[model samples]
Target: MALLDRLRTREATVGIIGLGYVGLPLAVAAAKAGYSVIGFDVDASKVERLYARESYIEAVSPDDLAQTDHLCAWTVDFEQIATCDVVVICVPTPLNQHREPDLSFVEDTARQIAAHVTPETLVVLESTTWPGTTEEVLKPILAQSGHALGRDIFVGFSPEREDPGNATYRTQTIPKIIAGDGEAAQALMEAFYGAVVETVVTVPTPTVAEAVKITENIFRSVNIALVNELKLIYDEMGIDVWEVIDGAATKPFGYMPFYPGPGLGGHCIPIDPFYLTWRARKFDVPTRFIELAGEINTNMPAHIVHRTREVLDRAQGRGLNGAKLLLVGVAYKKNVSDMRESPAMRLMQLFEEAGAEVSFIDPHVPQIPQMREYGIFEGRAALDPGRISDAGFDAVVIATDHDAVDYAALLELGCPIIDTRNAMAKRGLPMDLVTKA
Candidate 1:
């Protein structure tokens, strides 16, 4: 069957499972591309919000929702997905306590799909997983339906190319990397995605597609960690690492700009790389570089806390105990309101334990309820610069540097500051008031 023919007939209901950062955007794109889309999730509240056009993801605008509403519906029910022609799994693939790939979510999702597998439907795995996960782990469970691949139904893999908060490339603009088990499967999958995404790049097999996705994320993890390590070394040398990076960035060749920060956060950078490293060991290969990068990134919060302690000592006899500290931002990245795996939570707890009262200010996130790291204080509304300056804080930590923060107001506050994001120097805040780490 021709890929376009299936799409045109409306026989292909594009069902996106686990509508979070990845699935929501994909569902929006597919529905906009004229496919009937059923966005399924286990979260009932999320389903209700999507139906009302209340978006959780920053990139998925109300305009996207309005355009797709005619053909789209959100549900917590698995039975809704039974009628789908193409099922794309975009569930979370997090690591366990031992830093091993937690495949329980993926396995469970696959089992649900297996129960509904039909000869005409196409199943594609979009969650970021270890290489060989699709064929080795998913395929067998899916085949439990007594249907053979290529003959009975179609199976493929397309890693979700979701860049949350990226202004340039969105779900449809970013080219998709796809691979299928066989010729027929590849054709069906390519046509399905080509309708929504701008370009579709096909690899030889599913494993190659998996490897490509991990490599892209791991490269980011390593480079960010390298700059983070440099941030520490340069701090001890009394040189501003942020300034150094700006100067080095003038070289057009052999350099890519990566800023240092408190630590790695978000769904992809810190978590996805470890999935690859964990799987590589099964093949008797040790991913030393990837592991080292993760280690440096993970240790950054502790280092930031230590720097804050030093600043407290320099200021007064006050330890972090009862010292008023303001965390500038809580989101993992600037301009986005996602706090998953954010290091700011760790820093907040560290300061509170040392007897410091911590409050956060981010335009993106007004109030952060006490999370796992700290459970005592309820978050306040947007930070008032006038009140904060007058409040006599012992020190300020710029954990997440949101663009909305008034840089000049912070510099004029006349309080000692420990900057992990290099935002103070970048905004040309007074050198005397700023301390780097």
Candidate 2:
């Protein structure tokens, strides 16, 4: 009741760890809702940028950061978490080289929070992971603080549904799903998140909350893989996938359109589904759909490469082995700077391996930053009409269809193009110059 009173009266200080895409928006929303927010991160540069009211994420603007400056403080010190009344862990749960769940970030953040967690302090994890993670992995680590759960301290799991660059739904509008270890914890968390978001869904257990997020992403992964497979089949049957999808969408009763792309990209769709597959192995359950979806999605980049070679050979009687190509839009999705698990990286590597010189142009990303697995492409080519006219490339691959691109200009160049995203079709470009891959 004390915690609930503090949260209601706007006297509670909210602490959010890992000030990236998910955490930063949450911190801002909490601050805007009249709570003092402390954003914690290990990166010194990101912390420094936050203090200066600079936002690196596309969803959070610099104006939003400046407005929250009075109520928000960005820090790198873990001890400052002790001053917070509630702490939320929004860390990344990336997969390892073996495509298994890697909970190192979440585990490390829980250990840090345990060191400073006090009696009556509410702690919630917003990182997406497999079921039983909250109970099996985090609870034991947090118990080291010696404060009994639901009696002295409270804990919950609330999966983040942050969609970057989404104009329709902001952090406050998206319905949050929350589950707690006990009734006390559930009540406190529901009250806390309810203050910021428009709607709150309370599940029975923490594992169910974790499974909800995984299920949402798995549905997308499998559906996207289905569309990609259909795209290949329809292409072989001399049919346009975009036209077929449009006609099917007109039915409107039992259909939701999921477009096919070069491959799966972004932090969530490409990685989160596999966490379930890894956990299912322990329970002796076979996740055939998940494994098959992963296989199809993983092979998309190679398929795009093969289509590019065929397009080049059919158009100009030249092979991709010695040709020069330009890749348009290197980011994972449209109108965002995030490049995690982007298919463009794989396409670039495939082009280079086949002895072709590749250059990229992305309006959102002027220069490609350093990535964990992908090598950095040093020079960024200009996307202007003059440059496209001057640089004689064998073909152009529309990997990501950002709105800022000049689709008409690319078509006017009269060059062979592999339109993996159907941007050319959307722009009413002629089929003669554009090959729908």
Candidate 3:
């Protein structure tokens, strides 16, 4: 009841850890809801940018930063978190080298919170992780502070649904799913997010909330894999998979269109499903659908490379060896600068191995940032239509079809084009020049 009163009165200071894509918008939303927010991140540069009223993430604009200037403060000091009445953990949960769930970031954040958390302060984890993480992992860690869970300090799990470039859904509009360790914790979390977002969905337990997020991603991964497999099967039969999908869309009742691209990208779709697969192994249960979808999706980049080589060979009567190619849209998706798990990296490696020189053009990403798995490709070519038309390349692969790229101009380049995204077809390009891969 006291927590409810503080939240209702907007006297609660909300602490948001990890000011990346998810945390930044959440902080903005919380501040807009009239709560004083303290944005925390380990990266000093990010903290500096926030303090300077700058937004590094494309989803968070300068206007958002300016609007929340008085309401929010940015800092790297973990000790300051003790002053927050509600602390939300929005850290990254990436997979390790062996594709195992790496909970180091979450664990480190939990330990830090335990060190500074006060009694009756609500802690909610918004990172996408496996079930039992809130109870089995976070609860035990917070207990080390000698504060009883749901009694002295409250805990909850709420998965973040942060779509980077989707203008249709913002942090406040997207329905928030929340679950807590106890009734008190659940009621407090419901009121907290309810004050900020348009809708707050409460589940029975934290495990159920975790499973809900994983289920959504797994559904997308499986359907996308199905379509990708269909693309391969139809390609051999000289049928256009995109046309088939269009025809199937006429049904409109039971069909949800999941487009096939070079491969899956972004933070959630590719990685979150596997978190469940790894957890299922603990009980000796087989997650065949998840494993099979991962297998097919992972192989798509190589398939795209093979198709590109075939199209170039048939057009110019030469192999991929020593051929010059241009890749359009290196970012994982359209209209965003996020490059996590992008298939373009795999395609670049394969093109290099095949003795082909690959250059890329992305309006959103001016310079390729350093990635953990892939080496940074120095120098980005301008996306000028005139420059692309004059550049003599053996083939051009549309890896990512951003809305900014001129598809019509790309068709006039007078080279074999492998349209992996089917953007050329959608733009009414002549079928002779554009080969849908």
Candidate 3 weakest ten by summed lDDT: 376-385
Question: Model 2: which ten-residue window has the lowest total lDDT?
Answer: 376-385
C-alpha lDDT values of all predictions: 0.85, 0.90, 0.90
Greater TM-score among 1 and 2 belongs to: 2
Cα misplacement distance, residue 184 of candidate 1 (Å): 0.8
What lDDT tens digits, residue by residue, belong to model 1 across residues 1-437? Answer: 74437865655788899988999999998987889999999989898888888898898988889888999988888976678889999999888878888999889998898888676778999999889999899999888878787777678999987776799999888989999889888888778888888899999999999999999999999999999998888878888888899899999999999988899888889899999888888899988999999999999998998888888788675677788888899888889988778888888877777778887788888777544334544465656666877777778899988898987777676777888877877776677877777
TM-score of each model, in listed order: 0.95, 0.98, 0.97
Flag the better candidate by lDDT, 1 or 2: 2
lDDT string, candidate 3, 1-437, tens digits: 78778998899999999999899999999999999999999999998888888888988888998998999999999999889999999999999999999999999999999999988799999999998899889999999878888788999999999898999999999999999889999888988999999999999999999999999999999999999999999988999899899899889699988889999998898999999999999999999999999999999999999998888778888888999899998889988989888998889889999999887788888777777677646454445555776678788999998998887777777888898988887877787788888
TM-score between model 3 and native: 0.97
For candidate 1, give the lDDT: 0.85
